[model samples]
Target: MRVTMIGTGYVGLVSGACFADFGHVVTCVDKDPSKIERLERGEIPIFEPGLDDLVAKNVKAGRLSFTLDGAEAIRDAEVVFIAVGTPTRRGDGHADLSYVYAAAEEIASLIDGFTVVVTKSTVPVGTGDEVEAIMRRVRPDGEFAVVSNPEFLREGAAIEDFKRPDRVVIGTEDPRARAVMGELYRPLSLSDFPVVYTARRTSELIKYAGNAFLAMKITFINEMADLCEKVGADVQQVAKGIGLDGRIGSKFLHAGPGYGGSCFPKDTIALVRTAQQYGAPVRLIETTVEVNDARKKVMAKRVEAVIGDLAGKTIGILGLTFKPNTDDMRDSPSLDIIPALQAMGAKVKAFDPEGMREAAHLFTDLELVDGPYEVAQGADALVLLTEWDQFRALDLAQIKNRMNQPVLIDLRNIYKPAEARAAGFLYSSIGRA
Candidate 1:
């Protein structure tokens, strides 16, 4: 199949590259000249693992290409995917669908024959209808089927998730459209990955519902961590006790600062607003959003409890990205926690293997250092913010000696309490007696 993907952002780039690797001719289109230029020159703009190699391999095989203008690609393609960003609107908290709608209009004008237009970006329910309406308004006689195909790829492990998805939910009632989508995902279907065909609205809701549930799960564990702290219990054991049941399982149960990334924060808020607009409300999700927001800010106080006075204190931060292996800083816990510490008269120095370049723009007065040891040097306290792989097995004794005062606040609970304490440092962690 010949596929034209509009808007070469994270979703577009990754999906286009993967589709090309599946032996489809893919042309990724972006309005940004520099982004398209970078892709053409074998330079990947994002830091996803194995993505550069995948893109390079497919491009060398003449199956993947990049373009600034997608007119020719759209006219010749059998499938045109609107993989643009649907970020939250400023005040309304609704998904900003302008980019998706604009892509529909452009695709409507250029598509020559039968085309299956797929929405690969995470969007609110009924967006497919609106996109169809917009395309019809632009070209009334165009023969195109608008389908909803929301992406569920994680940031750090997108390629693996794309290749071996738990399931593929494709939304379409049109037989021709379903056939095209099926052929597009034939590789996965052949490998026994389930492809669920559903109504467009249901497919859209599935993405939001799945994300909201995961966000709520994280919040539940975080709340449990607080209760465990008060009751002299360990939250890790609590998670283990509950997770042993096959029904509950164990994912997103780690007690950390909070849930933060591109999807959860924005999608939960969008779902809440969408539900209210439709004369129904999800109160649990509303509470999940509220608690997760408060959790991030409250983490700074945990450090204060150990150090006593924050006035003129220097704190070392371990990680800055929301999670490791990706440079995305959107809604990261460090964004909330670091500023709170600074407001309380603490100076902060931080290090992350990949996130520092992007973190520099989101933070002010934050000292980005060379390495984890550099962050530890002369600091009054060390806060392990994000649990990068490198930070897991640091020389605890060496870090203890380098700090002005030996203090370790393990937010992610990456270190054993006894081991940290035995290293001759004042140690504090989440949800343990």
Candidate 2:
């Protein structure tokens, strides 16, 4: 299949590259000249594990290409995917669909023959109908089927997820569109991955509902961690004991600062706004959003409880990205916790293998050092914000000797309490008494 993907952002780029690797001819289009130029020059604009090599391999095989103008590509393609960003709208909290609508209009004008237009971006329910209406308004006689096909790719492991998805949800009633989508994902279908064909609205709701549930799960475990701490219990063992049950398998059960990333924060708020607009509210999700926000704000107080006074103290931060393998800093917990520590009069020096470049733009007066040991040197306390693989097995004794005070606050609970205590350091962790 010949496919044209609009927007070349994280979703667009990753999906387009993966589709090209599946032996489809793909042209990724973007309005930004710099982004297209960078892609064309073999320089990836984002930090995703193995994405650079995947893009390079597919491009070398003549299956993937990048462009600024998509007119010719759209006219020749059998499938046109709108993979643009649907960020949360300001004030309204609904998904901002201007970019999706704009792409639909452009595709409507350029498509020559019958085309299957798929919305691969995470969007609110009923967005497919609005996109179809917009396309019809632009080209009344155009023979195109607008379908909803939301992506569920995780940032760090997008390629693996795309290749071996838990399930593929395709939303369309048109037989031709269904056939086209089926052929597009034939590789997965052949590998026995379930492809669910459902109504467009249901498909859209599935994306939001899935994300909201995961966010709730993370929040639930976090609340349990708090209770465990007060009641002299360990959250890790608690998570392990319950996770062995088949009904509630352990996935997002780790107790951390909170859930913060591109999807959960924006999607949960959008779902709340959508439900209220329909006269049906999800109070649990509303509470989840509230609790997660409050959790990130008070994480600095945990440090204060240990060190007594943060005034004129130097703190060392281990990680800055939301997760380890991706350099995405959107709504990361560090964004909240770092500033709160600074406001309480503690200067912070941080290090992350991949996130420092992006983190530099989000923080001010932040000392971004070259290595973890540099962050530990002369610091009053060492805090592990994100559990990068390198930070897991650091020389605890060396770090203890380098710091002004041998204090370790493991926010992600990466270290065992007894080990830190035996290393002659004042240790504190989440949900372990």
| Model 2 lDDT per residue over 297-342, tens place | 9999999999989999999999998888899999999999999999
Residue ranges of candidate 1 with Cα displaced over 4 Å: none
Cα distance off (Å), candidate 1, residue 341? 1.0
- Per-residue lDDT tens digits for candidate 1, residues 161-214, read 999999999999999999999999999999999999999999999999999999
Q: Between which residue pairs do clashes occur in model 1?
A: none
How much is 124 displaced in model 1, in angstroms?
A: 0.5
Q: What is the C-alpha RMSD of each candidate to the true structure, in Å?
A: 0.7, 0.6
Runs of candidate 2 with Cα error greater than 4 angstroms are: none
> How does each model score on lDDT?
0.95, 0.95
TM-score of each: 0.99, 0.99
